[model samples]
Target: MDIETWMRGYETAWRSNDGDDIGTLFTDDAEYFTEPWTPPWRGRDEIVRRWVERADAPGDWTFSWHVVGVDAGTATAFVQGETCYAELATTYSNLWVIRFADGGRAASFTEWWMDQAHASDGDGDGEELG
Candidate 1:
């Protein structure tokens, strides 16, 4: 699967949090790492379970991403994304490394995320700047 198409599907899965939609993105033996250092959710079943457990509510957030690089030989793609949580007034930057198996399903996926510091007015109180 092409990076763009796969990413679109991922966005759909993220919004829907449907097990079947999530399952379509990964291989049977796929591994998903929520953070670089954390142990991955191994296999499609576990991945689906974990994803649903931590699913983001629809309309609470918005995300945009772009492919940074791709290595065709290894079927790997690097992507960068930004997520804004409208209700929480928070934003996060994300980096994902994906290794695609045959048929375009991800064999392995790892993500690194950093919360963006909210802009504050001069006041010491934690009020976010609009």
Candidate 2:
């Protein structure tokens, strides 16, 4: 499958913030890591659940790809994004390690977004901790 196509699907799904759509982009065993202060999820089921929970927002969650490095079956994509969490506004620079599935209809991916403390402090007083 083409990397561009894969990325398009991923990006579209992300913007939708619809877990049903986002979860469909990956294989059943694919894991998604979305931690600002907790353990990462390790499967599509978990990914969808958490994503749906996040979809309960005041405003839409948006993401923009900044840069990407791809080779063979793996890709590293960095993106800048923001989300409205109830009342607090949050922004982040997130990274993803994508491993395309071989002979499967889905791809394996892992997401690593910036820590909340780091985002709040902005290279200043607070200690950066993941």
Go through the candidates in order and give each one's C-alpha lDDT: 0.94, 0.60
> 21-117, model 2: which lDDT tens digit per residue?
7776777777665553456666788878877676644245555564466565343333444333333466556666666676432555666776454
- In candidate 2, residue 13 scores what lDDT? 68
Which residue ranges in model 1 land beyond 4 Å of their true spot?
118-130
Find the 10 residues in a row with the least total lDDT in model 1: 113-122
Largest TM-score belongs to which candidate? 1
Backbone clashes in model 2, listed as residue pairs:
none
Give all TM-scores, in the order shown. 0.89, 0.61
Clashing pairs in 1: none
For candidate 1, the per-residue lDDT at 72 reads 96
| Residue lDDT tens for model 1, 1-130 | 4999999999999999999999999999999999989899999999999999999998899999999999999999999999999889899999999999999999999999877875567598978777
**Cα miss at 117, model 1 (Å)?**
1.2
In each prediction, how many residue pairs overlap at the backbone (N, C-alpha, C within less than 3 A)? 0, 0
On the 0 to 100 scale, the lDDT of residue 107 in model 2 is 50
